[model samples]
Target chain A: MNASITPITMPKFGLAMTEGKLAGWMVRPGATVRAGDDLADIETSKITNAYESPAAGVLRRQVAQEGEMLAVGALIGVLADADTSDADIDAFIAQFNAEFSAGAAEEADDTPPEPSVMDVKGRSLRVLDIGHGEGDPIVLIHGFGGDIGNWLFNHAALATGRRVIAFDLPGHGGSTKDVGPGSLEFFSSVVVDLLDTLGIDRAHLVAHSLGGAVALTTVKNAPSRVTSLALVAPAGLGPDINMEFIDGFITADRQKTLIPVLSYLVHDKGLIGRKMADDVLRYKRLDGAVDALRQVAAANFTDGRQTDNLRPVLETAPPTLIIWGKDDEILPSSHAANLPDAITVEILPDTGHMPQMERSEEVNTKIRAFLAH
Target chain B: MSKKSYRQAINEALRLEMRRDPRVIIMGEDVAGGQGGTSGVVDAWGGVLGVTKGLYTEFGPERVLDTPITEASYIGAAAGAAATGLRPVAELMFVDFVGCCLDQIMNQAAKFRYMFGGKARTPLVIRAMFGAGFNAAAQHSQALYPLFTHIPGLKVVIPSSPYEAKGLLIEAIRDDDPVIFLEHKVMYDDEEDVPDESYTIPFGEANLTREGDDVTIVAFGRMVKLANEAADKLERQGISCTVIDPRTTSPLDRDTILDCVADTGRLVIVDESSPRCNMAADVSALVAEEAFDALKAPIRRVIPPHTPVPFASVLEALYLPDAAKIEAAVKAVMNHKVTEAA
Candidate 1:
C-alpha cells in the first residue's frame, strides 16, 4: 500500500516469452541501484537478457531466488528507501501477491502486443504496430537478414507516447521471401510503400544497417514524407564492410558454423548462443530466403565495398540522428565521421553493430531527447 | 509457430514438400486408407495411426497411393520410382515389417548411387513407427534404427519432439540418399510448438537439451525428453548434467558426444532399443575408444534388456527405460570414481 515502494517484476522481451528464470541477482538486498542499471539476469528459452532496474532505490528484498522460474509480471524483488520497515515490506508483498493472484494480472491488460501479417505492395510483411499518438509515428527498419524482432529491446521502450511500427522486410522473418531486385533503391520503394500502406504520412524512420541505406534512398526519392531519420550502425556512409558476415550469413546453415558468424554482430561473443543460430537457420531454410539474401548481398556489398553511396543525400536530409556502436565490426563506426554540421552522431562504446539492442535504454533516451526538441 | 502434435507436424512436412516439389509422392499400405475396407475407399484413414490423415484428400491417389499390404513390393516400387526421377515417401506400417523389405532398402535403394558409379539418385523416405509402448507387442513394436544405421548408404533419423519431427521429415524427403525416418508410435499425440514454414535440421549435429557440469546424458528419440526430466530432477540434489539428443543415429554427432564426455568425465546413455547393439552400446564404445583418458567414472547405459518387447502393459512398462531409470543411471555415473584417475 506504500507509494514509496516499487516492485521489480520480470521483464518480457518479446511476444513469445511468457515465463523467465531469475538466472541470478546482480545486486544484493542492501545495494543501491539506479533506474536502467542491471538488476539481474533473466533468462528465457531463447536468450538471457539483463533485467534493468525500474526505479532508483535500495534493493530491500529478493522475492525470487536464483534459478527460480516465474511468469512475466511476477514480483521478483523490491526497491524502496533504506529505512522502510521489514514488517511493512512483508505486508506489501502479501497484498501484492493476493492482488496479483486474484485477477489483477488478468484485468491489467499486461499481455504484449502480437505481430500480424499485413499486405504491403503485393507482399505479406509481418508487422508489430503498437502505441498511439499525434506526433510523427516512429518506424523501425532492421538490417540485412533481420526481422522486426531485431528491435526487441528498443521497440516497446520507444513506443511510449507515440505509435511505433516494426516490420519484417521481404525474404525475412514471416514475410514473403521474394525480395524484388534486392537493391537499396528497390527496398527504399518498399519502405515508402509500407509507410503509405500504414497511413503514416511524415514519420520518423529509425533504420539499421541495410535499412539505413533504405532510409537514405527513401529521402532521396521522396523527401516530403519524412520527418526525421535515426540511423543506427547504418550503411551507405562508407566504402568498407565485413564481407565475412555477409558471406557467412548466406552460406553457414549449421549452428556450429553459424555461431561464430553471429558473434561478429555483438561485442560480447558470449551472447551468441545456439538458439540465435537456430532461429536464423530456420528462417534461411524457408523456400526463397537464401536466394533473397544472396541477391541483397550482391547488390549492397559487392566485393566487400558499399555499392551505393547515399552520403550525398545527407546534404539535403531531414533532422538526422546517427547512432553507431564503437565496436561495430559489420559497419565501422568511423563511417559516422565528418557528417553535416546539423546532424547529431552518437558513438557508443562497448557495443557492436546492434547498439539499439546492446544499449537500448541509452539509445531510447537519446532518441527521446532528440525528438522532444 | 503454434502447438502441433507429432502427427500434425509430420503431415504438415509432407504437405509442404509436396506443394513445393512435383516429383514427391506417397505410397504405402493404407496410407490413403479406406482401400478394400468395409466401406468404399475415400481416403478415409491416413495410416494405421492416422499420421498421414489428410494427405490423401489433398494430393489425390495419383500421388498418395495405397499399395498392396505387401511391404516388399511397395518398398521396392518406391525405391525404383525414386531412382527414376520421383521422390517417394513409403510407409512400412511398423518397423517390424522392415524384415520383409530389408533387401529392397539395404541393397537396392541405399546402394543405388554408389553401385551405379554415383549416377543414380534415390530420394526415398521410408517412414515407419517404432518403439514398444501402449501394449504394441513384439510383432508390431521394435526399435530397428540400428539395422538401418548398419547400412552405410542409409541415413537413420529418430526425431524426439514435434518440432524435430517436422523439420527432420522435410530434410529426409529432400535428401538424395535413402532415409529411414523412424517415428515412435507413442509420440504421435505428443505436442510442441512447431513452425509453420518448411525447415530442415541438418544431419550429424547433436542438440544439447540440458547443459551442466557433472555428467553427460546422451539419449535417443523419446529418451531425450526423459533425460531432460531426469536432469531437472537431479539438479535439485546438486547433480548437474548435460543432456544431448543426437537427433540422427547413422551420421551421429560424434564430436558433440566426445566433447561432452571430455568436459563432464561421466556419461549415461539411454536407449529404448534391445540392448545388444543399440545406440547406448555404440556411443559407449565411441567414448571408450576416443576419450578414454577423460573418464572420471565408468559410463552407464539405461537401455531395455536384450529381449523381445513384452505383450502385457505391466511388462512393457518394465521393458522400457523411464525417467526414473535414467536418473538412477546418471546418479550411478556421478558417484563412480576411479582411484587410479585413468
Candidate 2:
C-alpha cells in the first residue's frame, strides 16, 4: 500500500445506496484537493450528493469517467502528492482497482442488516438492531412520521462498543400503521412493550423531536427501565411547534411541495434533496400513513400547542442531556433554557430541528460521551 | 428493506393492512384452509400457491376468512361487505374463474357507485392469479386484464415485480373504488428488494424499467419481464430500447407510453393476453391516435396467437410471448421504414 496515494472511492450517501453514478467531477485532474472539499457529484437512487474528499492531495487521475455508475467503495479517482511519479501513481491505481473489484464482489455477497418486525404487545414493530458490545444498550426512538431510517447517520457511529437498536414507532416505518389515539402515553407504552419484547431491562433512550416527548413520558412512567435520556428538540419541552411543518408534511403529496417542507428540518435547506423528500412522500402515500400522521399530530400538536408537558421528568429523571438546534423552526431552542440547572443542555447553532442529522458528527460525539458517563 | 419473493410481498401487504385496520379482511378459498378436515389442522394451504401463507396464524380466522369454492357468492359477499363497512380483499383463485363471478364484479361492484348516483363506495380488491408458464392449461392460465380494463368503473392492476406488488396491493386496498389486482402465478417466486414499510404506488402510473433511445416497448404483467430481457439482448446488438411496465392496465399510463414512443420513434407492445382486443391492441390504438406524427416506423405487437393457451410444455412455451418474440418484434419495428408511394 502506498502511503502517499489516496483513493477517492464511490461514497455511500445513505444506507440504501448500493451503487452511485459519477454525475460529474467537481475537481479535475491535476487540481489540488483538500479534505471536505467537493470532489465529485455522486448520484444515488434517492438523491445526488457531492462526494467530499477524505484526504488532501493532488488529483492524479479520474479513474471512473463522468456518468459512469460504480458500486460503493469502487475506486472513482486517485490522489497523491505532486512529486509522485506516473509509474507510482499507476501502480497505486492498479492495486486499488484490483482490491476494489474483489471487495465489491464480497460486498455483493454480504447482505446489509435487515429490519425485522416484532410482535410488541400484538402491535407489529419494525426494529433494526446493529452492533454488539457490553452496556445497557442504546434505544433510538424517531420523531413524528419518521422511521428508524432517520438515524441512518448516527446509529452506526454511536454503536461502536454497545448494542444500538432503532425502531419504527407504531404508526411509522415498517410497523403497523394503526396508531391507537396517537398520544404520547400510547406511544410510550408501545416503547415499553418493545423494550420488554427485546428482554432489555435498562437502556439509554436517544430520542428525536416527538420521540423526546415519548422518552420523557416513558421515564416518568417506568424510570427503572431507562438508563439515561438524550433529548433532541423534544416535543414536551415546549408548547409551541411549527404547525405549518406538520401540516405540510402530512398533506404534501408531490416532490415539489414536500421538498420545501423538509427544508425546515435542517439549517442547510440544500439537505432537503429530491431523494429525502421522495422517501417521505413514498411513506406518506402508503395506505393509512397520512391518516396515522394526522392522528399523531391531532393528539400531540393540538391547535399549534404541544399537549404534553414532561418538564417534570427532567427535574427528577435520570442523567439527561438536552440537545436543540438554534435554527429549529419547529421547536424553538429557547425551550432549552429555564430547565433545571442540574440538567446539561447544548443548543447547536446553524442547525435546525434535526441537529442529529445536520451536525451528526457533533451529535453522535455528544451522545456517545453522555452514554459513557 | 430486504429481498422478498412476490408471494411474501403480497402476504406482507395483506398482513400489514389487516393489522392496521380491523375493517380490512381476507376472504378466499383455502386462504386459511384445512377447515372441517380430518387432520383437525388450520391454515393447511394458505391459498393455492401459499401467497397468503402465515397470515392466518397472525390475524386469525375472523379477519383471514377461508371461503367455499364459490366465486359468485363470495365475490358478491365481498362487494356487500365493502359497501357495508369492511374493506374486503377477496381472492378469485384464478383470473380465468372471473367468468363465474363477472356479474358481481362488472355489474354489482363496478357499477354500484354510478348506478346509485355516487352514494355508494366499494373498497374491494379482488386478487386473482393470471398468465401462463406452469403448464396450468387453458382455464388455469389466461391474462384477462383486458376484461376489467373494458369496464367503466373498475381499476385493474397487474404488478410486474415483488416491490410493485406490495405497494400496488396496499394502494388497491386503501382505494375507495373497486380494484382488480391480478398476480402472475409464475412470478410468485421472483424476488426483489422490497421495503417492509407500507407504501403505495399510485394507479395509472407507468414504471420505466429501462430507458433507451432506439425503441419503446410497453408490456404488462409477465410480459414486462420478457420485454426487459429482450431489451437487454437488443442493447448488445447496438439497438437500445425502453421497457415500460404500465402497472395498471385499466387506468393505463397513456401519457408515459405515448411520450416514450415519441422519444424513441418506434413502439413494440408485449402482451401475454390473446391477440384480439388485448392490452397490446389497446395501446397500439392509443399510440396511433395520439402520436401518429411522432412515429417514424410502423407499430408492432408481440402476443400469443388467437388460439387457446396450450396444455403441453412445448406448445405452452410457444403460446406465451417469450423474450425471443419480444426481441423479434422490436427488431421488426426498428427495421420498419416509411415507404415512398412507388
Candidate 3:
C-alpha cells in the first residue's frame, strides 16, 4: 500500500501463458530501475521476452531465482524507494506470497475459460471471446496455419480499450478443418459470419498473413462493416512467396523434419520453439487439417504463388495499415513497396514472416497507433 | 458396394465411422498425403498401403487428418483429444512404428480410464499394419500383438481375415476403451465376405475357424490363417484339430480355450511372435492352469525362436511359426506321452 513500494510480479506474455520461467534477472539487487526498464528475462513455452518494470524503484529483493518458473501474478521480485528499509520489503514479500497463493487457489477453484463451438452455416467453428467494453470491438483473424493463440501476444494488448475476439481459421486451429474452397473469399465470409453471430455490427479487423488477405477481402466486400484494418505481413499484396516453407510446413510430419520447416518463420529461429512446432503438428494431426490445409494452399497459393491480388481492394476503402518484416522469406518484403499511397506500409528490418510473433512490441505499437487514429 | 479388398473394407470402416459420428476422427502421416505439393494434388497417398484411399476426398480434410511424421505429438494429441471429446483413430502406419508412439498408446490412452478413476473414456483406436509375408524385414514385419496384449486397459485386436477386419475394426472404433487394432498386412488383399452395414464383433469371443476332435489349435492374427492351414492338413492325415481364433487378446476368451482343451484333451498354440512370453505361452499357461484335468497329453507351443525377425527368405521362414511348424506342433501334442489317468 506504500506509495514508493512497487511490486515486481510475474507478467503474462500471452493469454494462454499462465506461467513462465524466470530465465535470469537482468537487473541485480539494489539496482535503481525506472518504469519500462528491463528487469528480467522470462521464458514462456512459446517464446522468451524481457520482463519490463512497472514502476520506478530500487530493486530490493530478487526473490525468484534463475530457471525458477512461477505462475502469472506471482511475485518474482520486490521494488521500493531507496529510503525503504529491508524489514518493510521482507514483510511485504511474505504478505504478497500468501495473498498470491490464496488468489491462485481461488482461481483454480473457479470455472476455467469456456471455449464454445458454434455452427456457422454448416461448418463448426470454435471461438474464444474475451474482454468486454463499449465501442465497435476488435476481431482477430490469425494468418495461414495460425489459430486464436497466434494473436496471444497482441489480443490482450488491444483488449484494454475494446472487446477483443480471436478465432482459429478453418483447418488451422480448433475450428472446423473444412475450409470450403480454401479461398480468401471462403475465409472472409466465415469471419464476416462470425462477426454476425457474435452480434457485432462493426469491428476493427486485425489479421495476419492469410488472415490479412481475408480481412482485406472482407473490407472490400463490405467496407461499411470493418472500422479499421491491421494487416501483419499480409499475403494478397505479394507475388513472391516461400513455397518451400509452405510446402515443408504442410508436408513435414515428423518432429525432426518439422522443426527445421517451422524455423523459417522467424529471424530468431529459436522463437519457433519446440512446443509451437508440436502444436502445429498436433493441429495438422486433427481429422481434416491436412486436407483443409492442402485445399487452402492450392486455392490461395497456386504454383507456390498467391492467387488473390488485394492491392486494388486495399487501395479502395477502409483505413489499412500494412506491417511487413523486411526479412520475411515467406512473403518477400518487396511486395510492400508499390502499395497505393492510401495504404500505410511499415517494413521492419531483421524480422521474418511472423512480425506479430517476432517483433510483437513494434507490431503492437503500430496496431495501437492505427486504432487510435 | 462392389467387391472390396480387405484394405478397402478397413478404409470403409473408418470412412463410415467418421460419417456416422462427428466426434470420430482419423489421423496419421500420409494418411491423406500431398498437403502442399507442387502438383496441387492432395490425398494422393491415402495411406502407406492405400488403406485410407479416397477418404480425404469423401470426408474432406476435417475428418481425415494427414499428420506430419511426428508420431508422438499427433498420437499424443489423439489421446489428449480422445480424453477431451473427440474419438480419434490414429494410424501408426505400421505396427513397427509403435516404437515411436508407444508411450502415448500405452501410458496415456491405455491408462487414462483407470488412472482417472473411471471418469475418463479414451475411445481411441490405433490402426497399424502388422504380421509378416510383406518381406518388410525386422522393422516393419513384426507380429507384436503380444506386446500390446500385455498392457491393461488396452484392447488389442488382430483381425485374421477381411471379415474379421471390418467388424473388429468397427468394434475397436466404437469401443469405450482404447484399442490397438492390428491388421495383417498380408491379408489386406485376401478376400472374405464382409457385411456392408455397420456391425461390431464383441471382444473375448473366439471364432472357431475349424472344428475337429484330435487337437485344439489356438492362434491369433495372421497365425489364425496358418493354424487353419495346419488344421486342414492334420484333418487330411486323419488327425482332426479345432482351430480357435481368440479375436481379441486382452479380453481373451479363457472359457473358449478351456472348453476347447476339455474337448480335444490335447492343445497346440501357434504364435508368430518370439517364444519369450508370447501368446502361445499365455494360452498354454491358461489351459495348464484351468483345464489340467481335461488334458490327455502335454500342451505344445509353436512359436518363433527368441530373435529378431530375419530378412532372408529362408531365415525369415524359419523365424516365423508357419502352418508346417503348427502342424508339427499339433502332431507332437497328439503323440505326447499320456500319464496314467491323472
Candidate 4:
C-alpha cells in the first residue's frame, strides 16, 4: 500500500448516530472522485444521506459490500493513487482490519458525546459545544422550529480550528419551553445571557432564517461581544415572508402533512425523509411546544409580514458574509440583495431556506473563510 | 434527547399527561402502596415493576389510586371513570390476568362508543406487561396482545423501543376511545435515546426500522428487536431485509404491509404470540389475499408453538421465537423458488 492510500469509512450523521448501513455504493472500484463527491448512501436511524468522499483519489477497493452495516469509523472502501499496486492495497486493508479489531473492545463502550442542558437566567438551554482550540468560538443559531441537530453537517466541519457551539433556543429540542414573550429582543437577550453564562468575551454568530434576524439583533444590542456574522436565507431584511410554511409547521402533526411542510426548507423534496418528519412531530408533541411556536410567529412574523427590518444594523456590523439559497421558500432570497457592499453575499442556486443543511460544504467554507479574518 | 429505559419512558409519559390534564388518573395493584402497608405511598412499587414509582408522591394518593388486587373491579372502575369525565390509565399487571376482567374490557369499555350511538366517549388506557423471556411461569409470562387486538373498538399498542413506548403511551392516554398499551416485560431495562418532553406517536402508522430490497419482515413488540438482529445477520449473507414494526395491531397499517410486499416480493412475519390465530397468520393471510400477484415465494410465519409457557429458563428460551429461528425462517422462504408455467 502506498502512502496515498485513504480508506473510506462510515460517516456519523449526527451526535446520536452510532452505526449506519451502506445502502449502496455510488461509484465502481476504479472510478475517480473529487473530495466531496457522493460515494455512498448511508442509512442511519434518522435518515438516508449521501456519504461524500473525504479526499480526491482513485477508488482502489470496495472493502465493504453494499447493504453492509458498519459502525462509525469502520472501513468501507479504499482510495489510492492509480499507480499503487493491488498487492499493497490488500496489505493496507489487512493492517487496517487488524488494528480496527484490536480497538473494537474499547470502541464498543465509546458513547457519543451528547448535548447537555445549560442553565441560563433560570431557564434551561440545550447546548452542543464542540471543539477546543484557542480562538474566538462560533455560536450557531437555528431558524424557527429547528434545533441544534440541524447543524449536523456543519458543526464538526467548521469546528476544525476554533470552537463551535450549537444550541436549541427556548421552546425547541430539549431546551426549556418558556420562550418569554417570543420577541426578537427576548431571543437576542437570551443569546447575551448565554454568552455571559458560558463566560465568553467575544464570539462569532452564524445563524439561518429567523435566527439570522436574532443574530443581527444580538449584534445591535451588544456590538463588542460579537466578532463576525454569517447569515443564511435570513429574515428581518424584508417584509415578505412565507406564512404557509410558518402556519403549516405549527399545525402539521401527522407524517403525511409534516413532510410537505418540511419540504419547503429545501429544493430536493427527497431530502425530507420519514424520520425527519417524525423528529419534528416528536418535538411538536412536547408540552408547550406548539404554544411557544405560536407566540414566536405572532410576535415576529405578524399578519404574514416580518415585524423587524434590521438591515440598518449592517452599517456598523463586523465583517459579515451572507449566503442565501436562491430557491428559498420561507424567506425570499431577494432579502440578501441591496446589502452594503462592505458585507459579502453569496447566492446559491437550486437550494432553499436551509442552505446550511442543504449545501453544508459551500456554506461552511464561506463561513470559515469569513470568520478567518 | 437522552438515554432512557423503557420503564422510565412509560413513567415519564404518564407523569407528563397527568400533569397536562387534571382529569388523568392511574390505578393498579401496588401502583401506590403504603396505603395500609409499610413502604411509603409515593415510593412504593409503581405497578408490579416500579414503572410508575414517582407518581404517587407528585400527584398524591387521590390521582395515583392504589387499587385492590381485583383486576375486574379496578378495570371496570377505570372504564366508568373515563365515560363520565376522567381520563384514567389502569394497569393490568400481567396481560394474562386480563382473562378475569375480559367482561370489563370487551363487553364494557371497548363497546361504549359503538353501543352508545357514538355519543359517549371512553378515554381509557389499560397498560399491561407482556411477552415471554424470563422464567415468570406460564400465567405471568405470555405475549397476549393478540387477544385484545381481536376485540372491536379497541386500539392496541405494542411499542418496540423506549422512544416508541413514551410516544405511543402518551397518544393512548390522550385518545378519546379505549386503548390497550402492551409493554414487553423483559424490555423495561432496554434503553434508547428518548426525548424529555412529551410526544405522541399516532396509533396506525407502521414504523420501518430497516429498509431493504430482498424481503419484508413484519414484527411486533419484543420480536421486532429479534427480527432486526436476524435482518443484520442476513445482510452480511447478502439477503437484505426490510423490518417493519406495525406499532398498533387493531388498526394495522395494511397499506404499508401490502406496499412493502409489492416491492420486496417476499414476506416474513415474526409474531411472539401462539402459532394459532396470531398476527403472523393475519398478516400472512392479508398478503396472500391482496398481494398475491406480488408474491414470488410462499409467505413464511415465525411463531411459538401452541403450548403453555414453561417456568424453566432453558425451556422457556426454546419456546420463544428468537433471532436464529427468524433467520432460519427468512432463509427458508428465500430458498423457496416459485415454479413458472412452461
Winner by TM-score: 1
Could you give candidate 2's per-residue lDDT for residues A204-275 as a string of tens digits? 999999999999999999999999999998889878999989999998876557878888888877667656
Clashes per candidate (backbone, < 3 Å) = 0, 0, 9, 1
Q: Model 1's DockQ?
A: 0.46
Q: What tens-digit string does per-residue lDDT give for candidate 3 at A1-373?
A: 5666888888888877788878789999999998888899888987877788888889999998886778888999999988998888888988888998988988875432444677877767777788887788899888878888787788778888578888888887777777879999989999888888888899999888889889999988888899988888888886777888889988986445788988888887757655676567656655567788889989999987899888888667688888888888788888888777888889898899888877677788889888888
Task: Write one digit per residue (lDDT tens) for candidate 4, span A1-373.
Answer: 3579998988877667788888789999999999999998887766567788999999989988877888888899999999999989999999998888788777787776678898998989999998889789999999899998888878988888788999999988889989889989999999999999999999999998889999999999999999999988888899999999999999997776788998888887777877788788879888789999999999998889999999999999999999999998889888888889899989999988888777777788888888777
Residues B108-190, candidate 2, lDDT per residue (tens digit)? 99999999999999999999999899899999989899989999999999999998999999999999999999999999999
Ranking by lDDT, best first? 4, 1, 2, 3
> How much TM-score does chain B earn in each model?
0.97, 0.98, 0.96, 0.97
Per-prediction TM-score: 0.93, 0.75, 0.56, 0.91
First chain of model 4: TM-score?
0.92
Candidate DockQ scores, in order: 0.46, 0.36, 0.02, 0.55
- Chain A fold similarity by TM-score, each prediction: 0.93, 0.89, 0.90, 0.92
- Global lDDT scores for all candidate models: 0.89, 0.88, 0.83, 0.90
Q: Once model 2 is optimally superposed onto the true structure by TM-score, how far is the C-alpha of residue B95 displaced, in angstroms?
A: 3.5
Better of 2 and 3 by TM-score: 2
Could you give candidate 1's per-residue lDDT for residues B1-342 as a string of tens digits?
A: 678999999999999999999999999888886655666767666788888888888899899998887999999999999999999999988899988888999889999999999999999999999998869789988998888888899999999999999989999998998999999989999998786888888888888888888999999999898999999999877788999999999899999999999999999999998899888899999999999999888889999988999999999999999999999988888777667645
lDDT of 4 by residue, B1-342 (tens): 779999999999999999999999999888874454654334655657889888888899899998888999999999999999999999998999999899999999999999999999999999999989888999998898888889999999999999999999999998999999999999999999898878778888888887788999999998999999999889889898989999999899999899899999999999989888889999998999999999888899888889999899999999998999999988998899778889
In candidate 4, residue B71 scores what lDDT?
94
Q: Distance from true position, residue A197, model 1, in Å?
A: 3.1
